[model samples]
Target chain A: MFKKVLVANRGEIAVRIIRACRDLGLKTAAVFSEADRQSLHAALADEGVCLAGFKPADTYLNMDKILRAARETGAQAIHPGYGYLAENEKFAARCREEGFVFIGPSPENIRLAGNKLMAREMAAAAGVPVIPGSARGVVSRDEALAIAAETGYPVMIKASAGGGGRGMRICSGPEELKEEFSIARAEAAAAFGNDTLYIERYLQNPRHIEFQILGDSSGRVVHLGDRECSVQRRYQKLLEEAPSPALDGVLREKMGAAALKVAQSMNYFNAGTVEFILDEKKNFYFMEINSRIQVEHPVTEMVTGIDLVKEQIRLSAGECLDYDFSSVPGRGWAIECRINAEDPENSFLPSPGTVERYRPPGGFGVRLDTHVYQGYSIPPYYDSLLAKLIAWGPDRKSAISVMSRALREFVIEPVKTTIPLHRRMLADKSFADGDYDTGFVRKFIPVDEDED
Target chain B: MAESPKRLEIRAPIAGVFYRRPSPEDPPYVEVGDTVKKKQVLCLLETMKVFQKIKSPADGKVVEIVARNEDPVADGGLLMVLETD
Candidate 1:
């Protein structure tokens, strides 16, 4: 095990990693930007380094500075707690070059998974089911139209290098394709510096289910289970739950096997997520792989009784898989609501300011993961995530009931939050019946009523 | 001087740490009473590991420096005051 590890990220995830390291008897070093001098992550770590700027590139994404801090702190490893440089292949390679263990997958695996087109090809080659789409980048208008017709109308034009819902357009008919194609191309060029676009058959009302897979250096892999992350706004997942209400024992086993296959194809080790879009007919299609710890990992941990962060560190330290995959025990359902500091009433504009009052819900089944307190000022330079409120119960219904009560108890004053929106979502009959899809939030939360 | 010069505030365009010099070993970009031309580099706003040159909007004399070196500043925070003739 690493004696000391440097966390190359910030906010709740950084705090999460630091706590894990402490529990494993490892000292932690936290790197923060100038704006995050008083951040909870920095205060929690045994040692802290100020990277001297507010922007992500200067702080969390500054590989040289982060590596230097690790060296200075004598940290034997670095844990990138998602986002920023967590999925950056170069940063992982640099850690190896600098002789510090990166507590995640190898650089090669990250690079392969980072490219959408290549990842799809790899998934298909591994015999994993993928969505029907063009074989390569759609070059000319004629080719795009042809591919659209073959794949059927309602095809998705996506950037080859895109993620997080950017550079993507869903066209239902021929007329919309031309305008959407050009617009997607321009957006892709501006966002990813690549005009390369691919076409895929759009699956309407699919449930976004992802399996959490963990692997060791010995090439042994196992999956924890699936997470239902369909409750999203603009492709940003707002809520996640384990033991997806949609999946049964048979479907769960099938998805788990597919997730393992994806990991095996790359010899992927450490913690990673294989995302699949499951249609209403129970057919699952490979979406992409997230090659790091995810924001919604807590739901899996709550249900499976697994410390994923500790597992990542142990695997990176060359430890073998300690648990059996086939017989992994699971408790009842767990649901997590990502409480972000955004005004849902005001088009979800970021609400960054001092937290005049702070009170988090506490009960038998509720857990709050956050880095904020009274008087803590939320800097507008980073993600708007304020906290994650997870509720675990004997069943999905109980979990939802507990989450509803817990969300009502949680409070953060002055700064508007998505708490109200979450409250509404929990009360909605569709959400309670588990009949919602990825488009649930968009329809549930109506457009600003005052908007022209 | 027929009339007092109009004092203009040079505010930060983004939230970051304000640096008075390009590098640690170099002298400050400008001092009180230093004349600057339009688009001349006044100071640097270091954010996301990128050093953005904060240039003067117009020819002016530096009258006051509000932000200290390495100060964490918010967007629109005053960095310095310039007197335009």
Candidate 2:
């Protein structure tokens, strides 16, 4: 086992990894950019290395600098704590080649899951249900109609080479498809220079559900439970909770088994997340596999009583899966709200400045993971997430109450945060009742009238 | 007595980390007491990995570099002072 570990990231995640390493009696080293000299992670670590630049490319994302820091500090292991180079297979491979334990999945596992199409194919091959869609681009209207008929109506016809909502049309019946299918082809050719089009069944107002899975070098894998992250803005999750309100025990077991099957198919080890989209009918389709630790991992941890970062380190060191999943059963419910340094009223623009005053909520069932303190100057060079506030309770209702109370108590001054938005979301009837889907957050945000 | 030279300030165009050189290994684009042409790149301000080149507004001799290399700077933060005839 390695005695020292280097955290190859910054912000709250780096702080989290350092704490986990410390708990395991391992020496901790932190790498930081010049802008993050005063960041809590750097000061909290036993040793720190300055990466000599402020931007991510010159600092956090520079694999060479991270490797050099690990080598110089004599850190036997490197933990890429999400974001930055966490999912970069080449970086993981380099660390392994240099004899440093990378605290995550193997490079091969990352490669298998990194490609979205490949991940979906692997999931399908492993008997996991994927979203129903055409296997190839449609060459004729008849082919499109046939596939749409098989997949059901309300299918989305999209250009093979277009993105950003371009060259896309949704048809609810054969008449609409007959009228728009050819129009979409011409539009695709004019816009993307490709007339190729594909069709996929569109699930209106789907809920985002993901399973947390852990595995070891011995190929044993077990899923913890599910987290519902449907509360999102612009595809970025703002709040997440464990024991998805929409899932019962039977559905949970079925989806958990499916998650395990997907992991086993890739021979995945360490910590990974299997994301799925659940339609209104409760049918879940495999979306993709996230090979790195996710931003919303705390909810799973709180409910399972498992330290994921610690588990990752142990698994990377070739330890066997020691946690008994059946005994845990993901007790209680947990909720996490990401607090970002952005103004909710001002279109969520970044608000980077000195945090003149800071007060965080505390009490029973509350956990906060953060690196900011009073007088801390937030750098403008990175993501605006300032902290993650998580609350646990015996049930979903109690968890929501605890979170609302905690949000009311927390305070940060002179710099805008998403706290106000969280407060509003917690109070919304639909959110409190867990009767909302991915489209829930859009109602809160006013439409940009100036946009064409 | 000769009039004092006309001093003009060059401010950062964006909020980011200021750098005197294009890259760490390269020499600084301009130093104090160095003559520079108009539109010559004086420094770089990088945020989110996008670099915005801060260029000289006019031909002049740089009298003082206000912003240090590798330090975070705000938009409109002074970077250098140029003395022109």
**Considering every candidate listed, which one attains the maximal DockQ?**
2
Candidate 2: which pairs clash? none
**Can you write out model 1's per-residue Cα lDDT over A338-410, one digit (the tens) per residue?**
9998778766766677899988899989999999999998886788898999999999999999999999899
Root-mean-square deviation of candidate 1: 6.4
Each prediction's total of clashing residue pairs, residues at least 3 apart in sequence or on different chains, is 3, 0
What is the Å distance of residue A165 in model 1 from its true position?
1.2
Worst 10 residues of 2 chain A by lDDT: A443-452
Candidate with top TM-score is: 1
Report the error of model 2 at residue A226, Å.
Answer: 0.6
Per-residue lDDT of candidate 2, residues A394-426 (tens digit): 999999999999999999988889999999999
In model 2, which runs have C-alpha deviations exceeding 4 angstroms?
A136-199, A449-452, B1-14, B17-73, B78-85
Q: Write down the lDDT that model 2 would get.
A: 0.88
What digit string (tens of lDDT, one per residue) describes model 1 on residues B15-66?
6679999777789999998999998989988643335788999999999999
